[model samples]
Target chain A: MKWIDAPWIELLRIALEVAATVAFALSGVMMAARKRFDAVGVCVVAFVSAFGGGTLRDLLLDQRPFFWVRHTEFVWGILLLSLAAMLFMRQRHFQPTERAMLLPDAIGLGLFAAVGVDIATAVGMPALIAVMMGVTTGVFGGVLRDVLCNEVPQAFSDHRPYALCAFAGGWADVALRQVEGTVVSPLLACVLITAGLRGLALWRNWELPAWRV
Target chain B: MKWIDAPWIELLRIALEVAATVAFALSGVMMAARKRFDAVGVCVVAFVSAFGGGTLRDLLLDQRPFFWVRHTEFVWGILLLSLAAMLFMRQRHFQPTERAMLLPDAIGLGLFAAVGVDIATAVGMPALIAVMMGVTTGVFGGVLRDVLCNEVPQAFSDHRPYALCAFAGGWADVALRQVEGTVVSPLLACVLITAGLRGLALWRNWELPAWRV
Candidate 1:
């Protein structure tokens, strides 16, 4: 908590949040484009992807004035990003692909997980619940994007270790928090471990065990 | 707000809410069964359908201790209902069908819409936003159910006027609130109008114009 009071740390947190939001928004934009959605639909998808996870976490935690609402600039930023993405893709004749979204999606997942865990822990939520919130924050946005696109959530069905990475990262955060006087920021540790694990999973093509039923 | 303070009104409201929740949960149970989901999946879907819309509304309004959390009985009730449903369906050799879900879904929509509007208005939200909350509460649970089942939400993709019924009902509630010394309960009016409209739509096979693009 004291670490968060440092101006530089607060700035870093905001910067990471913005980066994660943009990454998630881009993934939504790509999904919408692939689905042949119109302009408004594309923007809606982007907004949902950017805000859905944190919104859900806030709701569960009973927080007021949602993160996006408190920071209206996020709304404007996503809008401009969505518009730019559409125009840029059209001009370049870019074919949006799932593979193109992987990196950004992974990065967003890690950052969001870190933020979600931090917020939940700040509110005195138990470690298990905090970890779940982290996983929810990291994975729910993409799940929503896929759902809106009328597909089973890739996080649930793709057999890729998406949420599991967030789960591990959340635990890493809890472990770090328990250690006294560690210079390593728990948030940074979470993001690195999560994104790195996800990267390796993709590189090695790891898969979770699918339900047999 | 004074009207809501009446003990009888409070009792009636709780009764309607319980009915609505069960109806929504039943619809979810049927859908999950149709999809051949396991017991855990069926219960999850039922819980989501029963609480998803209200949860979203609570989040939007920044309400604490979500409806389901505040009323632990609702959670237990849904758990029992889900188990009972699976057993009964199996014993009866009953095939779960979309048609079987219509009546319960419509009733749930009407009741949830009324409750959502009441809650929003109680919080001093503007009429338009309150009405939107009503529509959201009526429609979002089913949307989430469909999404979890990996289909486009029928509320959006189906040609039927589902949310439109809630929209009209919301406006009716708004209009009634403006009337001086009305004997009729606005909640009852909203429910009757919404459910009646939905029933008519189903009977007449009414369709909304599809997007051509």
Candidate 2:
């Protein structure tokens, strides 16, 4: 049996997921170039940022050959994109501006959360764990990327509610599934909730509580 | 019920695992200092090197609280070690020559592999997956650490059979159990096989097939 529902709806989720992964992957590649990291370094950041969350989900869920293992295309997709981005960086025309990348970054974050909730639902994870998984999968890639770059992860920073935003959206997603009581398609409900709250978070400039030492 | 035949044996395992984790965590701290990574970077690398395998295993098994979560003391132990190493590095004389660090590094590799295999066996994953988990846990911390340090992991290098040696020892441990039946303690078998093979590999020098392109 196919795990995904409504081919078109699934496609919508995947399209945005791929977009977000590409966007996040590009961010890492750019950072690598700035750091003068070698070819392997560039690939490491790109791969970890793009695949870390899904890899964790698969590992936790015991889903294997792993998503990347089976779908070499996704790996290739990132490689091709990384190459293009690297080339563009060599020229000045297509230089990636960090400011311009935020939209895709937020969209990717929301899309990944939706995917996480959907996967958790299919696997029968409890609601809280599911929400946590969603948020972790959504934000952990960037967190890992930042930590690897020898900087504090924005997710852990108090300046912005990076992980908090993902967590809120994930909680909303799970809550919607429960309150709707099988009336709503869980996938659509998740997608809508994650995307909506993420948008609200960005627009409102949400911040989480933190104290500097 | 207590899982092991004798209390002393179990205590030995716990003691050894703690020592291995501490040693590995210190190695990570040393690497971070050599590169001048920040305090957050030190903590992250220490955590990953010490807990990365168990975390990955628990996540795959969907086990709650994770290993470190169950043994919060483990993190406390590693943290204390990291702090000591960092303070020591400020005034201590150390050179990260691969030649000098090889012995403890190899010992840690084997010990971690044994722990990983033992955990996977308890969780009842496939034997192959369990062996792979042992290897993954043993080497992946260094891989993550090296990547964070902006260097290529020696695992992917033509330099040596780093992961291959761990995989061999882990499989030997598992295979020995199948031959000896349940008479011998599996944990003991695991530790013996891992330490023996890993020690020999490092002492005599071993390498695995690598693709250079």
Candidate 3:
């Protein structure tokens, strides 16, 4: 159950967790706003995008009370953020741009991917399942968000490098875990690999070939 | 865990489970076929619509290994059915219609709603949450299906009595459980209540008032 015994690493994990949550929450808010969802819908979408993946991972691992149920503050945080964003957007006539979401979204994907791998491995899951869980945890929230917004999941249809980046990072994590006396922190390395690849893909307009009938 | 210990009730429950799975799987297949998805996509969508709700409920209840994992036959069955459906549609030039799906979908909704409530109550969850879980299980699959097909959830926007029918049936089950020596079986009563209400709604063209800005 102990992913990190060191105090510094624990603190760092907590910081990264917050960053990931906030980043995803913001992305959710923007998506909801773009769709002109009501305030309640906006909050619901935000909550789903920020927590859906972790919730699924927790359930698969048989964790109790679910994460949002265990930490009600996360729900309240998303609610307030969505409301505030709505008001701010209205006041400034601000039109949310997808570019604004990319950086935070990339960071959150990397952090969550790392966390998912650590949690699955700690639970004694096989390497393949653990890696699948990491990608699922990293990508599922966005899928849920897109679904709620009534869009074909960009992950599936747009042929973007989103899930691919998480998949690569997850394998990198599993590999690092097997290496004895790894020179770098596996979590940090996974995060960098995922975020860096995603950032590079966005900059270079990289795309996976679309599936055809 | 002992939702029904009586031999007859157990047999009925098993039958209902099979019927419900097949019904939802058919609905999923029809939806996917309408979209002209590839065989793999059809199978994935069929599996999601047949199992999505119960999977979420099980996860929230902290049940491990997932229902699908425990019953791999359901997976194989859905896969086979979806493939067969695609072939049949192509050969017959059958345009899958929503009306053709209503009967089985309603029956499956009722059965799954009852099962969801039974499972949640067996876990000692509060009655309200249990009822909520029931409605969620009944309707979430279709929600997932529509989302995957790039449509706003018919449940949310159609203003139909779909989820409300499940809500009412869930309360009926919870209430019947509290009553002593009811003339009818509580499980049977739930199924009748849910299916009857849904059927009536469809027949009468019942609609909920839409929320407007």
Candidate 4:
């Protein structure tokens, strides 16, 4: 309720939330299509991937009436997107290239990381926990998506710096918490850092060393 | 707090919760061993399998300090069990048969379904939603486990009567809500119905027909 009521800030938050949702939804849809899942499976997977992380974060914060439930428009947006995407892909026989997915996915991860940090901080979570929550928010959706698609989560196994990027951005958000009214918004700064790191990682083929036993 | 304060009933609930946790943890350990996961991976997978469903439920209900966080004993139980099981498995080179997993998994499913229904009802959820939540609690851990282990969810693909059994049992729990002073405890009745149906289904090799799209 309070979240839905915060005027201009709330409007900006909603916009970011939509962006994050669309990014994740696109990722989910692409995966589902790759798996050749039916239309129903595509929509379900897309919804879960788009909404799962924020839902988990909200529930952890004990926020009632989930974000999607509160803003049915988000749900509608995903549904419409999935429908359109599915139809377009079916008609055009187009497969989304991995490179096509990279930009939105990176942007979504950054937006979600910032949003997660902001929400957790608003709920008075400890700074470290808030940062962790931010990473969870950014990465967990993809984890759910990958899991549902019967793959080891890219976050856990691919050794890419996905979660690490979010982690760094979260720490940045926390460090810049005191610097209000700067030239760039701290939230925007967090987003930029995360997206930049993820993009750079992709470009440079950066990876965390895999642990083997 | 109220859940932990219901005296005798709470004690029974706690016992059931422990039983379910151990059952699920064992299944997780068995799955991890089958995958030949390292100790850390084993423990992480086991924890998620054992706690994921209830954690999801608590978050949805806006219950804070998640069930595992509040009942640290459950967390300890899972950790210790995972460790012991891993050591025993490694030393003996033992792989648990699917049959070994069947009984406990079924029992845990039933118990968790009842607990889910009870919690949802207590929170004043609609009967249908509560029943759905019950099935979710009963099946989602295994879903998470299967997904993490890079397999399609047995509930979705096995076409088995697993979740359907839980759904039926949950509906029974809801239906019997008005029946007070019954010979059978409603909770126990729900458990028996779910476990019985699941057992029979397994014994008879019953499955839902796969829908082709």
Candidate 5:
């Protein structure tokens, strides 16, 4: 908690947040392009993907002036990014592949998970609920994107350890916070662990057992 | 504004709210059953469809202690209703047709739209935003239901006048609110007009023009 107020930590958190937002927005752009959605649809999807999870977290936590509303730049950034991505992909005849999305998506998941857990813990949420919030913040944007695109959420149905990585990272954050006065930032540790696990899972081709009827 | 504090009006509003929640929950159950989702999926879908729209409205408006959270009974009621619906439908071999869903869904839409508009207006939102809130409250739950079922939202893609009906009803509520000291409740009027228009659309087989590339 003491380390949380450090100037460099705050800067690092903001940078990670921006990177995560861009990553999520890029995933949305790729999905929309693959679906051949119109320009308006593409922008809407990208905005939702970039902001939906944080918005949901804020709502559940009863926070005001949603992150996007508070930071108008996020809205403008997504709009411009969507337009640029659409044009660039179309002009180059670039195929948006799942393989291309893997790295950024994993990075976003970890960063969002760490931020979510911190916020929920700050608000005095129970440990389990905080972890759940972390998973929600990390995974829900993609869920919303898939839902808008008329498909089952890849997080739930892809049979991979996605949200689980966030869950573990949240616990690590919680555990690290318990150590009195350690200089090691829980936020950084959580992000690295979550993203590392996801990257490893992908590289190893790990799979979770799919539900059978 | 004067009539809002009236005891009978409050009672009527509560009754309509309950009816709308039940109707929305029913629609979710039918959809989940149609999709052959398991018991947990059925309950989850029903809960989402019943609560999603109002939750979204509250989030957008920065309302705290969401309506369902304020009333614990709503949560228990949906859980019980889900269980009961599953058993009854299975026992009766009920084939849930789209036709069978129309009446309840329309009633729910109108009621939700009226309530949404009133709440937004009470919160001092401008007329247009209030009307949009009404449409969001009426239509988003069903959108979530369809999204969960892995299909395009009927509100956007069915080419029917679903959200439009809510939009029209919201404006009626807004308009009536402008008239000073009317005994005729705006909530009642909005519900009737919205449901009536939706009913007419179904009977006359009206369709919105499909989007062309």
Candidate 6:
């Protein structure tokens, strides 16, 4: 029996990434409709924000031909959601605030980072590079999102603790993985750390020190 | 003494990618502004559409540290442009039907695919993966741009001659490199093929068959 596989957790991670993809896509559509952008532009933004981070993670890890290609379901979901958003946008714009995407987004941040770090570490990347990869996988998607949307990322701009929260969770997860003779699972460590940090940051308004030029 | 580097052509390639990046970013911002999206959403859309493809290609190729991280200037350019687009949006909303992006985007298609193929081949990737990388690098960004903006990618949409042109260019580039010792510059072959295909596509109204779901 493969005692270490953690299928349930993996499933949850997949589900979380999928949910985040949907939320992120909706975010793009909502913005596009608001801007009165043409159909092409709206769809482009939706796809990028939804898939950008995972694609980056997979690519850096040299895991081809990529997730969207393998999982027609993910691509299909995006297509259907995009069509729905376009058709009923005037009457029914998606509302992330109203929906419960925050927890899933938080899950995405942690899992993406943990998995990124694990891959980087396995490949013998330097600790700093691995950490950076972890953070990049975790937060770059949101940063890309904000930049395309035409603003400094809220975490980076408002001195909020977004990436840092992910970073902390990543650090703890990575560190806990090395405890002597402990069966501390990477997935469990990743989930707990990510969720914990994200929740704490939200509750306490934890923030990073802002750069002032 | 590195005498055969093709300085002018390399410069041209870099220049084209840069121009395409700006044009792509602008298109993103234009779309966001027209949709009346907030600043954050606009920036997110612009950044992802512009950087999403090449970034994905690099990461997938396991080009460590990633090109964007190494070439921080690209991020700076995208940032500056996204900011400008958001601020000046009310002054000038992008009209996609006006065709401001067709040429720059084509240049991007040619240059990015060529670069992606070059990078993949150098890394010893198999030919099929290399071509896929080239195509992904060339066209995925646009796919991404459309998705984020909440519309079906023109590549997968009705009668849009978008990705097929890029795909032909990438395959042609790969074939050119496979010639007898191919002392002939691979990138030059890529450039000619891509530019020709993309131009012919626009002029001749070439398009790929869309999925019939």
Error of 6 at A179 (Å): 31
Taking the candidates in order, what DockQ does each have? Answer: 0.14, 0.07, 0.14, 0.14, 0.12, 0.05
Binned by DockQ into CAPRI classes (incorrect, acceptable, medium, high), candidate 4 is incorrect
lDDT by residue (A1-213, candidate 4, tens digit) is: 354346777778888989999999999988877776655557657988898888778767776777875676676688799888887777787867777889999999999999999889877899999998899889899988887888778788878899999999999998898665331376898899999999999999997986989
Candidate 3, CAPRI quality class derived from DockQ = incorrect
Where model 5 places Cα greater than 4 Å from the true spot, the runs are: A1-52, A55-111, A121-133, A144-152, A156-213, B1-15, B29-48, B55-96, B125-132, B144-152, B156-184, B196-213
lDDT of 3 by residue, A1-213 (tens): 243566766577667777888899999999999999999999999998999888878767776787678679878888899899899999999999998999999999999999888778776777766776888788889888988898766665554588778878998988988883541377888899999999999899986542222
CAPRI category for model 6: incorrect
TM-score of 4: 0.61
Which candidate, 2 or 4, would have the higher lDDT against the true structure?
Answer: 4
True contacts kept of each: 0.19, 0.05, 0.19, 0.19, 0.16, 0.03
The deviation in Å at residue A100 for candidate 4 is 4.5
Question: Each candidate's lDDT (Cα)?
Answer: 0.85, 0.70, 0.82, 0.82, 0.85, 0.66
Per residue, candidate 2 scores C-alpha lDDT tens digits across A68-93 of 55455787788788766766666655
C-alpha RMSD for every candidate: 6.6, 8.8, 6.8, 6.9, 6.7, 10.8
Q: Tens digit of lDDT per residue, candidate 6, span A1-213? A: 133356764465566567657766776666666656788767777777677776766666566777678777987788788777788755665443423546666766776777667656666565555655677777766666665766545434444455666667667666766673332466457656876788787778765432111
Model 2 TM-score relative to the real fold: 0.55
Q: lDDT tens string, model 1, A1-213?
A: 577567876677778789999999999999999999999999999999999899878879977799888899999999999999999999999999889999999999999999899888788776766886898798888877887888766675565778888989999998888894532478888999999999999999987642321
Candidate 4 chain A worst ten-residue window by lDDT: A177-186
C-alpha root-mean-square deviation, candidate 6: 10.8
Q: Which lDDT tens digits does candidate 2 get at residues B33-55?
A: 77888888898888887777666
Weakest lDDT window of 10 consecutive positions for candidate 5 chain A = A204-213
Question: How would you encode candidate 5's per-residue C-alpha lDDT over B66-154 as one tens digit per residue?
Answer: 77766767877997998888887877877889889999999999999998998898799999999999999999999888888897677
Better candidate number, 3 or 4, judged by lDDT: 4
